[model samples]
Target: MPVDSTGHAIVAEGLRKRYGGTEALAGFDLAVPKGTVCGLLGPNGAGKTTAVRVLTTLLRPDAGRAEVAGFDVVRQAARARYHVGLVGQHAALDEVLSGRQNLVMFGRLYHLGLARARRRADELLERFGLADTGAKPVKQYSGGMRRRLDLAAGLILAPSVLFLDEPTTGLDPRGRNEVWEAVGSLVAAGTTVLLTTQYLEEADRLAAKICVVDSGRVIAEGTPGELKGAIGGDRVDVVLRAADEIPAAMAIIGRVTGGEPESDPDTRRVGAPVRERVAALTEVVRALDEAGIVAEDITLRRPSLDEVFLRLTGHRTDERAGERAAEEVAA
Candidate 1:
């Protein structure tokens, strides 16, 4: 049951949101093609969630404009709400209710008749791989199962667009994989999903395009590969046995790769971006050997999304998450 949305399903222009002294969004802009997954990639407190809240009509922007599924988010709030579904970071299932009952209850709250609600619940259970456990109480479900059910509850009416905010935040790897498969199936069925996450790997796997935001503004926007390329093509890394040899290794690697090398004195490691993989590796190994640096590790690999995020956000994802957590506790 596909909804009536074609072309760009979501659009935003110069969005701005300020929370007292903090500016969560500053001139943010976006465009997401219909039927494709678009990722909002940023560290915690980078305004990813704030932007989602504004677009989903939960928060009004201080300035700028946004449209979802062809409806203005502010002026047409009711119609926009009807076409979009939201799944927040935490699970919101009723602990005492069976998975099927929870979903049916959501449908009923959406004004679906009892019979239709039951049918929708069954469809969601089967689609999200919870058919076997539909009768089981939500408390009996695992982390992944509960998250999928949350997504299903958001989709009570087959919304044309869905917003997921950190859907895999605390799940184990297997659980994350399960949620990923469920999202993939939804996209295949023609739902345009806008996902916000701190995990770069999630955007790489699920998003056709990624928007990187920091300090309330979009710093970059492109396909995953394109964003990685902005940092560099390939990465050459070396780990030395002696921490005292950091300077020598950094110089050699910097000169060989022609890019600034990052030194990790804590780990006696150095890494730099490389455009010519084979040639750079050869030069780096030869230089280290001539300089009598006993490297315990040397490898060439493509830049991970972590590296991309670091370059775009100017901070490590973990560091930002920790800072945000501390701020929340203090507040």
Candidate 2:
């Protein structure tokens, strides 16, 4: 299938899917432009993986329509498959096979000639920085190496769009960073990527735009900064030297920021959203000094993606991840 002239690598509307009594996807919608990364962020059972399956033609939606690389997912499933690659949560590789052998096998499975398959395998091994370790058995590879090999397998045909569903799950920080760098390199060469991740920081770093999914619907969509700004601009936090000073500090913060302040009594910390970032911090400091209150620390900073997610969804991404029966059904 050729790339879509509309410049959207993937598009979906009113997608609905159900597993038994659970509605995995309810009126889900998405549009991802070519040559960019779009992130789907949500807790378990929010329909992220279900949406990916439908778009990739692995699972059919009960209703609605979608297109990938100019082909309708349902009407032209084969053609759609030709233009997209999927790296699922679990590794889909033969542990007994070497990394290079695995990629070569994938190429041959796609009907590339043996010589062409070997060439593509070598190319990908070098491209993903696994040239030296390409001959090592996948079972002996590090977590990051196995994942990079999985990514290489997904790119045997140089797909136009790639769907990554929690690609870095269970990886250590170093392994995760290695995958992130590889992904960045791919995007630089103009591959459209749709990433679904529970890691807010991953989404923030990789996604050009983010869709916050909850209850099978997108409750918010924007760039990371825009999403953070949607809830509140910047925040001022002050830790008092003594627990008894929290009340006075909250009052000072409230007066300076002109917003209601929240306090953690146990930590003796008071914080509030402030529109004027630096000015509010300065005023709070001056007010505390005038009131003869000592502050252990004071700082003003933009809200984190985690804070934005909590504010929008009222829960963390990891919360209920293992408890969602609907997710189990979808899986």
Q: Give the TM-score of candidate 1.
A: 0.87
Instruction: Count clashes in each candidate, considering only residues at least 3 apart in sequence or on different chains.
Output: 0, 0
Candidate 1's displacement at residue 266, Å, is: 3.1
Compose the digit string of candidate 1's lDDT tens values, residues 152-236.
9999999999999999988887888898998998999999999997766688899999888788888898998898778886789
User: For model 2, what is the alpha-carbon lDDT of residue 127?
Assistant: 90
Tens digits of per-residue lDDT for model 2, 1-331 = 3334497988888889989999998998888899999999877778999999999999999998889988999999998887999999988999999999999999998899999999999999999999999999999999988899999999999999999999888787788889999999899989999999875668888999999888777789999778766777678889888998887788778988888798999888898988878888889989999999998998775554455566897776554553332232222
Top model by TM-score, which number?
1
Cα displacement (Å) at residue 186, model 1: 1.6
Candidate 1: Cα lDDT at 283: 93
52: Cα error in model 2, Å: 1.0
Candidate 2 weakest lDDT stretch, 10 residues = 322-331
Candidate 1: lDDT of 252?
Answer: 90
Stretches of candidate 1 exceeding 4 Å from the true structure: 1-6, 276-287, 299-310, 313-318, 322-331
